[model samples]
Target: MKPLADRIALVTGASRGIGRAIAVRLAQDGALVGIHYRAERDKAEQTLDDIRAAGGDGFLIAADLADPAGATQLSEALIAELRARRDPPQFDILVNNAGIDDRKTIEQVTEADFDRMLQINFKSPFFLIQKLLPVIADGGRIINISSMASRLSFPTMPVYAPTKAALSTLSRVLAAHLGPRGITVNAVLPGATSTDLNPLSDPARAAAVRDSVALGRIAGPEDIAPVVAFLASKEGGWITGETIEASGGQRL
Candidate 1:
């Protein structure tokens, strides 16, 4: 559709699954995408390949988003990398789709687990956005990948749920702060999707989760990618400061 023509987008954790899908979608929508990955260099290249095969322009980036330094890398230095490809250019869209989910609850949650979850899911995105704020041009779009856990209290995901909630709240505040500059900040809350992060890898556990969804199935990466691309496009220009859940009607 070329709706995002001439726009530039940077997506973190764009190695596989949801991040990979979003990278392809953004490129398909006409934005030159910078696909970011941590150690999944091959997967990132695959994502870039898909974009190229689809007649879209895309580039690849690698960074450990879980690292504290990674946050600053994505926020500031990545801009230089992107600009190196095109002069007088700045990113118009940012998708904070990078995160780690802690399946452990309070009883099982270790100090290290909680720290890692908080660092990647909440802390990194928070600081990264702040660092990149100056480089984001006017009317930019910032999309954070939150989880439906933010809207519901949980048993096995105490730490993870709170992390998403904090991000949701951050979006509310950032929306107002960025509004004056014509930028919109928002969050996407997904219920349950089929990705590598699945703790229930066993057949029985997977079946249970699938049956619980209203769609009678778990979602794939494709299911979530389009929504992200839409939000970053002109169509989503009016949507901001809110968490939009797209989880096949899970009974949270």
Candidate 2:
């Protein structure tokens, strides 16, 4: 039997990039994925299509994580979908992968920018977990897609980095809180990955990032998906409250 044959997974920001890769990977592993996107319904549909092409299954969910009530909106939609399918109102994996980075310096960031970053990157995940705790199956997994910026200093991502740091801290705290239930909570930090949000169109910039990595290459979203898949697997049950960096040893 497949390791995740009967599992259900929800991956936020799954319309593209790392989130899309993770969602597709989970589906391939036998989980019925819930692909969440803030906008870009077409992209979300393509993700579902990819899953189907791989002989996997999934559905799309839309919610703007930047909104204060985004978490609630997402949870409600998930429950509704589950009910419509006559499945239990529960899931095995929750991937908090939706986030935004303004790539602004501290001096360039404004109050609005700070608030939006906090709302989407930190606050949304916090409230999403809180709202979905009851329906998250025992022995389930909660994977937060943080960033290496949480550990390394990136002057251009001042506000964005701190939000990811807070998320990593939240993962640690929640792992303990949910340990008694046998649930595993972890944070995945991917470094300098090639995604639309972090484009590397400039050869000089890409080369600079490439030289910093011990792996001597820029990472693709595919490189990070397996790490998350492992963490969501049964074997990953024993691991919790940890931050797994899939950065190819950048700056090491």
Candidate 3:
């Protein structure tokens, strides 16, 4: 049987990039996926189509993580969708993969920028997990898509890095809190992935990033998705409260 067969997964920001890759990978492992998008309805549909094309099952859900009410609404909507299909209103995997990238230097930061970063990157996940706790199945998995920036300093990403650091800390805390229930929570840090969020189209820029990685190349979403898939599988049950760096051994 497939590892994730008869399972359910919800991947936030699944409309494109890393989230899309993770959602597709989970579906390939036989989990029914909830592809959540903030505003890109078309992209979400495309992701759903890809899942279907791969003979996997899934649906699209829209929610803006930046909004305080977003996570609750998303939970409600997800429950409704599951019920419509005669499935349980609970899920086995929750991938908190939605976040915004900030590239402003310390001198360029503002109160509004800081608030927006925290609201979407950290606050949303906290409340989303809180509100969705009842619906998350026991022995489930929670994967937070963090960044290598949290551990490595960047000149223009002072505020953004902290948010990822906060996420990693949350993963450890939740893993401990949920350990009694057999759930595993972990943070995944990908370094300089080639995605729309951080395109490496420029040869010089791409080469610069490649030179920093031990793998001699910047990673793509495909390189990161399988790691998350492993975490969602039964094989990953024994691992928790850890930060798994899928950064091609960058800076190590």
**Judged by TM-score, which candidate is best?**
2
Which residue runs of candidate 1 sit more than 4 Å off their true CA positions?
199-201
TM-score of each: 0.94, 0.98, 0.97
Looking at model 3, the pairs that clash are none
Off by over 4 Å in 2: none
The candidate, 1 or 3, that scores higher on lDDT is 3
lDDT of each: 0.86, 0.95, 0.92
The most accurate candidate by lDDT is 2
* lDDT tens per residue, model 1, 146-212: 9988888778888888989999999999999999998999999887887876545788878887887
Model 2, CA-based lDDT: 0.95
Q: Candidate 3: where are CA atoms >4 Å away? A: 86-88
RMSD of each: 1.7, 0.9, 1.1
Worst 10 residues of 1 by lDDT: 74-83
